[model samples]
Target: MSTPTASRQDPSPATDAWLVIPLYNEAQVIGSVIGAARGTFPHIVAVDDGSRDDSARQAERAGAIVVRHPVNRGQGAALQTGIDYVLDRTNADYIVTFDADGQHSPDDARAMVSAAREEGLGFVLGSRFLEGPSPVGPAKRFILGLAAKVSSRSSGMRMTDAHNGLRVLRRDAAERINLQQDRMAHASEIIRQLAATGLPWREHPVTITYTDYSRAKGQSLWNSINILVDLLFS
Candidate 1:
């Protein structure tokens, strides 16, 4: 993967594809993620979801347009905030969602946007299973990948990574995907909305990091069963 930039000048994103990062207590890696994104895109918004740490301040220091939540909303809510901010404040043609724990690659962001534009795909999901050399453990690789396949089949999408945060959405599609779930279940909700809308969707390969920080903060394998149960029951 290409090295992320520590700081960079402003550069326009492809067709105004704004990058939106939803963060919790990710002060440790938020600055690096923003800096790595650099001038690669013009609008990079970081939504701090009521983190106990100084995540919002660090994101602002890294030159990102930061938004804050008064209370601890979940990741889905934070992402929704960023999406709404870009749609309301910026003339963005596309919106890309990314993780703030340095798990996602900034360079792959452009590729996802390009693919969305070229294929008229309303949503471009970043698929780890479609790519090579993932940092995910074997157990997670089996459970999540299997769940994704099942969900894709149910939703009529041929996706391989439904849980990955690295996704590019067309403006209309982004606006349409109103997340109802505030927690981990939001991932399934988003995909369900996409399937319900019957919007053109595609998946692109992306690299994700599995550092100790990410693994610690990430959802556990046990939670995977809960997510599926939520999807089934709701």
Candidate 2:
């Protein structure tokens, strides 16, 4: 499987994409993730969504501009915050929404950003299922695949994955998107909105390393239930 770590020879992403990471209580792995990402993408914004741990400090120390949410707003909210910050603060052409956990790879991020820039796509979504089987359990994969189907049906865009956290968006597309669902359901909401607005989009094959820490930190079964309920009713 292709690893997601960026190579030194690859064109730097700092000039192309503004990285945004939204995490809550990711103290253990966020530091290293930010440090590694900073090597390729220097302009990074990490949103600490009311984390009680040292997540903000670690990201700050790793050279990320930290944005703090006094209350734990969901990942969607944090991402929007980071995006808004970058749009208002910098003249960035592209915005990359990256997972705060160590699951996402910087190499894949760079490729997606490069793809968006070269192809002139308004949105680039990373898909783990495009190449081969994901590095996760069968049950988890099934659930995620079901969620992808749900998103596809709602959005009218047929794709292999929808809940993937890695994405690159053009400035105009990023500015137009509004994430109403603040929690897990926000993933599907994003797809639905993008499709609704008719953005030029593409999905790129990417890697997701599902470690024990990431697995533990992921949404629980009940959270999944809540997400489905929210998607269905709200």
Candidate 3:
């Protein structure tokens, strides 16, 4: 539970904002990914969810405060760990959940933070299905569109993109959330939790770049079904 380390990247004047990157077995590109994130954020907490590779080492080398899990946990657990680290160890006014897989962009994160401050929103969700056509292919577009509809129907909110990983939570909202689901299903669980906790939320448009690596690591339709099952059982 040491204080999260600072990187050589230019620190934002608002020291209370912390970016938490939850990843497992992403060593191949975690360094470069963290380096890119450093361009916008200074304080970073990279949670290594028991990756067998050198993810923690590379994250450290790239100047991220590394938190290691003794065993592999789901993304939900990793995010909860990072958020807990921020809550317990730092006076983090804001916490942004950014992916280590390079699918997410730092610019969108900066915009979310700005929106949180200017609009005084407790939660800011990044939506890919907002204005224009998505950059993704037809299959992905259909799946994501369905996911958004399912999430909106389940949570009773006008959700544009349901399972998007990029999100910003104000400190109070961050503390109130309790993520019990440890896998990809946690995405839906998040929306449910927000609804239950009565946290004020807003959404901003964002893009999910489909790189070769991200494409390879993308979830299948079966995975989506499993997420639905988890949400139903919970």
Badly placed stretches (over 4 Å) of model 2 are 1-9, 219-227
What TM-scores do the predictions have? 0.89, 0.91, 0.89
Task: Indicate the TM-score of model 3.
Answer: 0.89
* Cα displacement (Å) at residue 19, model 3: 0.9
Can you list the residue pairs that collide in candidate 3?
Answer: none
Instruction: Give each model's whole-structure lDDT.
Output: 0.80, 0.82, 0.81
**After best superposition, candidate 3 residue 203: deviation in angstroms?**
1.0
* Residue range 96-128, candidate 3, lDDT tens digits: 999999988887788778777766778888888
For all candidates, what are the clash counts? 1, 0, 0
Please give, for residues 44-73, the per-residue lDDT of candidate 2 as tens digits.
999999999999999998899999999999
Range of the 10 consecutive residues with the lowest summed lDDT in candidate 2? 1-10
